[model samples]
Target: MTELRHRGPAETDLQAADDFRGLDKDGAPDGDAHSDSEAKGDTGLPDVPVPPDDTPQVLNKALSGLSSRWKNWWVRGILTLAMISFFFFIIYLGPMVLMMIVLCVQIKCFQEIITIGYSVYHSYHLPWFRTLSWYFLLCVNYFFYGETVTDYFFTLVQREEPLRILSKYHRFISFALYLTGFCMFVLSLVKKHYRLQFYMFGWTHVTLLIVVTQSHLIIHNLFEGMIWFIVPISCVICNDIMAYMFGFFFGRTPLIKLSPKKTWEGFVGGFFSTVVFGILLSYVMAGYRYFVCPVEFNSDSNSFTVDCQPSELFQLQEYPLPAVLQSLTGWATVHMYPFQIHSIALSAFASIVGPFGGFFASGFKRAFKIKDFANTIPGHGGIMDRFDCQYLMATFVNVYIASFIRGPNPSKVIQQLLALRLDQQLQIFNSLKAHLTERGLLPANEVAA
Candidate 1:
């Protein structure tokens, strides 16, 4: 009261005025604005406010001493070696474990992508979107798993009556389950958020297309042979590491705008390194039946075995050298695995085209104004981040195998035969018998029997 005679306002009133001035025109505090700033800070965005020097340690002292770029490279190298070792261990463990790993990776990737959608569209409070997303994932998985089981384990499925029934109407059942989820989604849509709901629907489908579809192809590649799964993946890993190393040491010209750190130097270095690594790895893997042979169910052992005679693709052959090389090398041809030739294509794509997948992911992150997909892999971002290029590579390998490598699968044909009705089966059996008899491929007694 002694000094209030001349004071314009009390301290509390001045503080309230400052707070009011900080708010938006709607009179609500700009909490979202501050939240964004904090998120940027957490993600290490350059413009965000940095913590004070007195702030407590967040990272380990050993890691904290290194610059961010060095820390990223160091962490990536360690993770890469660990992952490579883990992959070999899984391969040794068998196809079932490898299939489970693929499934786990697919689920994690789908989760990361769908989580992004939820974050972006969360304010609209779209009903049943998450449920519908997971439901569709389940439905698609059922459809894919059913197809896989029918193709690879038809005998096992037929031995069990319940499984045989389920296998018969698998597609119809999957459709029905998906339709139920679709109906629930439709019923949950709010009138006010109709546009947002539809937008999220598209988002969910796109995510499925990108993540689940590619992952399914990866599984198909795995079943084709461990080489199909391993070589391409290893090539990609080699390219990634070599590219990073080259870029860190001598990157000058930028390769792409989306990923600023990518350099032409890195790209070229990675390509050569990947091709060499792929060929060498293919040579080594081709020697082992475990890597070169397709996975097949062994009913006697009740376990999968990679015991088929190695395909011509996996066998060593002498490829004739070109005129110029023949003169220089004093050799007409070089002995090498045919699979090694295919590995070149795989490695080339991993270098040339696979990077686009990473760029696409980068652009997506930029559009969303986020740093990493998620902090799922420390310093490496998410599993999605690591596998983005791998997925693209997997799709290419699957297509390549279908186009140039794969022949009619005998087991798949048997599965189709088993699916036929009794009348249809007899018709095919008689027609085949007649054709074989006419061609003199079957004995008269055998045909009659």
Candidate 2:
């Protein structure tokens, strides 16, 4: 009985040791299996964790531990709302502030793009690249801004003797400045890095073409009318937001390889939502002269004004309905703003073509293997990232204006005439009178005067 008892205790100890070892082995595999399942779940989507540098100051590290999806939504929503609020505030502040904002955005975008080029070509140690890029930017800005000032604020230009002289020789001065930069770039080129220097030269010029030129067009749109800027921009913003909302909920089929998360469902949903939003926003803005009137400097007020009579595009007009629609709705006509009709075109472009701009940026970034252009805006990548579609929309608006909306500016013509030499002005005046007389548009008495 004593021997049996001793054997039983030893058997129990052996069994306990085996169980302990088994638990260690089995537990390890179980943990590994759970991790494998998680990795499998995340196979398609990239692990885009927020970098330490890009994280917001408001968000504590503890909050950063939240799931990526939640963090994205939180950051995106907060920034979007803040941006919208700031947009309205700027609008209320008036056109001057808006112009300043556009200028700042342009400079920032230029910096971001130039910085990219610097980083990419840094290996070659190209000399004076950054300086040449900035010099070119300055040259371009001077040329464009001078033209804009001469065109839109002729009164102010004429009142100031220095500005008048500058405006008179603006193009020549701009050319001289650009030539100087070109000479400097050429002088700075080293024999060893000639190819690298030339490559960077092309890069700088292309970046200027994309960033500066498009931004100049945006300024033109803003001057034509606030509506030209606000409506198109709002359409893009609405589309971007709705696309995300739709995609988050119902996205399945990938839209493009460049942007895998983009889906056909989101694209379609954004289109309809943007169209509706554009039309409604246009309708409301049409009623406000502040939104519809072209920006003009007022010497008397010593400030800019949006006080001109609203253009025909902003006017309300009634159109007779088709017979089928009239029968169905019992209405013979519908009143609508022509600008609202144009908004459809704007929204359509913003919806259809605008996203391509974003895709192109995405492809460019992927080529460089960079996540975002710069961490300018939290959760939104950078200013360049947000404004990619906007730049495209701005170009469209400028083209549309030139094609359909722009008319001969009497003030601009008069300013040009006034800038001429006295003899030249008199000769042109006489020629105009003679032409008018031949057409029987000028009375003999007025012609003599």
Candidate 3:
């Protein structure tokens, strides 16, 4: 009996030992297998996260995000409008106040430029002193000699009043300018691996940016002849509205890879609508006080502005044509176009390049993997981000017109028949631009008279 019991217990112990070893060997391998399955994406689950016929909330979530973004846009727009209103209030009720406001806005704009540059090409170090000096130079060049610089360009091709003097001083002036510029470049290399070229480029861009933005605004205000500011702003707000509506409904094909949301359909639709509205708006404004003929002369000698007698004959000191062309300013055409080519080129540029400016900014955002430029606006980003395209658009439009069209380039038939002076012709050219930019905008006359 004792022998049989001992044998039975020994058999039981062997069975238990085998079971323990088997588990030890299988545990690690099983774990390894599970990990491998995970790595291989073998979820052993359904292909779709939710059924193809899932609840609306799945899609609703995406829409909800979009709506939230839109909501912020509205809030920002209202605030911006309110701020603009106050600015106008001061402009009319307080011209002095307008000066301060413009200065502040200009400075903030400069800050944005520097900040953006630093962000993108972070490798460069632009000292504060350089930036400040650049700003000072820009201010002097733009504000003090705004009209003079413009005249210089428009009349550059004209026979010089002092050709002999220019010839006499040409070499000396060239050497002086070259020496000064060279010194600046050499000084730029003073810092460790200093980037003088970039420094100059940055400064030049800043100067041009400020000049273009402010000068155009000033000229626009002058052209509109309005102390009431709503005229220009109407275009901006209307454009944003039209762009959004059109883009939402017809944004089928992506306008660009950087801004996938923007579509060709929206761009074309929005632009057409804006143009149609602008024409109507300009027509309505034609009868307003600000829309009066430039020759109306303010009649008041104490008027702050000079008699901006619209040039006749593309007339010059040497070729002083009859004053008959003066009547054509606002009386004949919408704006002035000294030459047709200049006007058309400007329009084409603003339409294409302007949009690309926005695209360029979008590319930058995508590179950084960010949604917006800043949280300042709900749907839009910062003022700089949102208006960067417009800034370039407005400037280029003006430059293109002033440079090419505001001259005596038109065939004699068109000039004599139309009796349109170069300046008046250019204005007509500008009218097209105005038409594009001023979709929902009120005309100067409507705001005033």
lDDT: worst 10-residue window of model 1: 42-51
Q: Tell me the spans in candidate 1 whose CA falls farther than 4 Å from its real position.
A: 1-59, 418-426, 437-449
Tens digits of per-residue lDDT for model 2, 114-183: 8877764553455788888999999999999998898889989998999989988999999999999999
Candidate 3 ranges beyond 4 A from true positions: 1-67, 80-106, 119-185, 195-237, 292-300, 305-353, 364-379, 399-449
Worst 10 residues of 3 by lDDT: 43-52
Cα RMSD of all models vs. native, in order, equals: 9.4, 15.6, 22.6
lDDT of 1 by residue, 1-449 (tens): 12222433333233223333454233556454445534543221112121133212343455687887777677777667878898889988987798999999999999988887776455334567888899999988898889888777788888789998999899999999989988998898776456556767888888988988888898889888888999998889889999999999999999998899999999999999999999999999999988888887777898777888887887889889999999999999999998898889999999999999999999777644666776676667778989989889989999999899888877678668877899999999999999998899998898757
Give the higher-lDDT candidate: 2 or 3. 2
**Best-matching candidate per lDDT:** 2
Across 96-166, the per-residue lDDT of candidate 3 in tens digits comes to 34434545555555554454444422323444444444544454434433443222222331234564345
Order of quality (lDDT): 2, 1, 3
- TM-score rank order: 2, 1, 3
TM-score, structure 3 vs. true = 0.49
Highest TM-score scorer: 2
